[model samples]
Target: MKTSQSYTESGYTHGHSAPVLAAHATRSAATSAGYLLPELEPGMSLLDIGCGPGTVTLDLAERVRPGRVVGVDPSLEALEAARDEASRRGDRTTDFMAADVAELPFADASFDVVHAHQVLQHLQDPVGALRGMARVSASLVAVRDVEYRTMSWYPDIPGLDKWLDTYRAIARANAAEPDAGRHLKSWARAAGLEDLQVTASTWCYTDPESVHWWSGSQAARVSGQTFARQAVEIGRSRADVEEMRRAWLDWGASPDAYFAMVHTELLARVPARR
Candidate 1:
């Protein structure tokens, strides 16, 4: 998802590039949204904010049959891909729209559940985004984000550290929080949401297939537009970006390479009507 409202910084950090979308399209509800599955019930309306390519959104729509499921993103390009994915899946009911998390164009209490994945981290005011989600959610609000600073990998590869540093700098330059997983609880509380249940999950890439895809996509991402472009804008040299891209490729080829990303999930219930 992309957000350009209520912020002075530049647009989405990753932009709407092919590599970014390819990486995001691999996410599924089972893998990315397992924590919220137990709470899902059929016939419940859902609003997926920042639903990027809508891979998870489409999977989620399957769980809530005969119910409305809408995916929203500030990036029209992302929405177009999402719509195309829906069409490919032969899903006729799911709807994709262009909207920012800062100002959802929906009535109060319009959805049974409001969810966002990897979206809040990109917002300058995540708490404000949560408030908007809470306003439109009658029952629950769920969100997930990764803490980039804690991401770990084995076989201490060269240039990886530089990659992390440069990525963080770029995100900060855009006024987005790269390490946002740890702050989900605080953000939700600050939004006045109550009954929060927080949990943690990990995405490990050690298997051959997983490692290849993860590393290749990252290399492509850093070498491609947006990330690479932003790194230069933040005083990093093109040589530094190229080095990181090479590092990712090297890591992918190593048999002992392992990577783990930590994500925090928050499930909060909307306060009862007063």
Candidate 2:
């Protein structure tokens, strides 16, 4: 898919390559879903923005069965893959569409809940997108994003440190925020949302299996993803990028290795329509 000006110029730094999609497919509704809403009514309508691969969208579909659930993204490749996943899972209720968050095609107050995950960090106008989402939600709007600066790994691997530096630089070059998690609430407020609730959460990789998966996926991402190319465009050498990839692999191989990435979650209640 061609990049959209509505999104970051880097346009999904972790492109939907096989390795990246494989990692995303591992996520499920129960495992990484529904932190924004404590409970979902069966009849609640939902719209999931930037719903890559639709894993979490399907989970939300299950939670609100007999209600409409739509997952929207600008990438047709991601929407097609998500449709295939839904078909494989026998999920007929969830729908995938190509839409930009800053200008959703839906009418005002069309959904009971609107959610986006790991999406705002990649957008050049996150607050503007949030305002658009709020316009379509009748009651709730939820968002979660990572603070790349808060990411930590054990044993102080130099390569990993370099990886972080390069990734942050690339994000900045794209005019997007790399540390968006800490600013979610403020963004929501600036979007004119009130009755806000903010919380922080962490995704920790400690077990050998989890660490291996996390580190291996990141290694492939740094070496083979669009992110790698963007890093080069910003004057980082290929050899340096390879070194970061190798460091990720080495960290994955370590028995004592652990990595934790912090995310900030915000759930805002939309004001009732007059």
Candidate 3:
């Protein structure tokens, strides 16, 4: 579990602000964890690392009924929100805790499966984190993350390009990889995980409602206090941040607006015990 030091050391770019939470609350198992669904059974204990609002965790819990589901993160606000979500969903079995990925507070082979969604990109030591995951997981470890640079949109806006560059710079400054999707294989190999299977997926937002929601939320995220403050700390002016917000809003108003984010998911089996 995360002590005060580990929690304080986590350089999560998107703080648990309303905007960030709102955006993350949309995640579900079908949308984010489909690649791992086929392998999940009704009685496999699972650990969700970096489970933000517990939306996806709850969905995954539903898939593994009667099996223990625990979601862990370093953010107290996020853990509270996750607990609230679990309660709202009437799910009594799932548990939420504050834990660091680099030092998972679990014994070896503690869970049948370990999963993380859109998490590796924000972590400073993803390889170390994977090693911890491999240590705890008895059978499988699943992870998915987006390649920020692979994101494509319709009617390309200049500010969107600037947004990508600025965001990448800020993430790198935090010692995190903004394009973590492409590195999962190498990280898993370095962590000594075996029998790796990798897959790719995309979230396409073309419908009017989806486009509007995605764009507006992104605008809020870029203009939010956490990102805005970090941007400035990394030499990005307020004007630059405003341009990113405007670009998202402008894209939302376009009748032909489209956005697709590419994600990579990896499932690796833990090495057998002697």
Please list the residue runs of candidate 2 whose C-alpha ends up more than 4 Å from where it truly belongs after superposition.
Answer: 1-5, 8-10
The lDDT per prediction is 0.90, 0.86, 0.89
Location of the lowest summed lDDT over 10 successive residues in candidate 1: 1-10
Predicted candidate 2 versus true structure: per-residue lDDT over 34-117, tens digit per residue: 476475789999999988788889888888889899999877777888999999999987999998887899999999999988
Q: For residues 1-274, what per-residue lDDT tens digits would candidate 3 score against the true structure? A: 1122232324886778888888899989999999999999999999999898899999999999899999998888888899999989899999999888878889999999999998888876788888888899999999999999999998889999999999899888777789999999999998887799999999999999999999899999999998998899899999999999999999999999988989999999887778
Better of 2 and 3 by TM-score: 3
lDDT of 1 by residue, 1-274 (tens): 2355552225677777889888899999988999999999999999999888999999999999888999998777788899999999999999999888887999999999999999888888999999999999999999999999988997797789999999888888777899999999999999998899999999999999999999999999999978887899889899999999999999999999999999999999998777
Model 1: residues with Cα > 4 Å off, grouped in runs: 1-10
What's the lDDT for candidate 2? 0.86
TM-score of each: 0.96, 0.95, 0.96
C-alpha lDDT (0 to 100) for residue 259 of candidate 2:
91
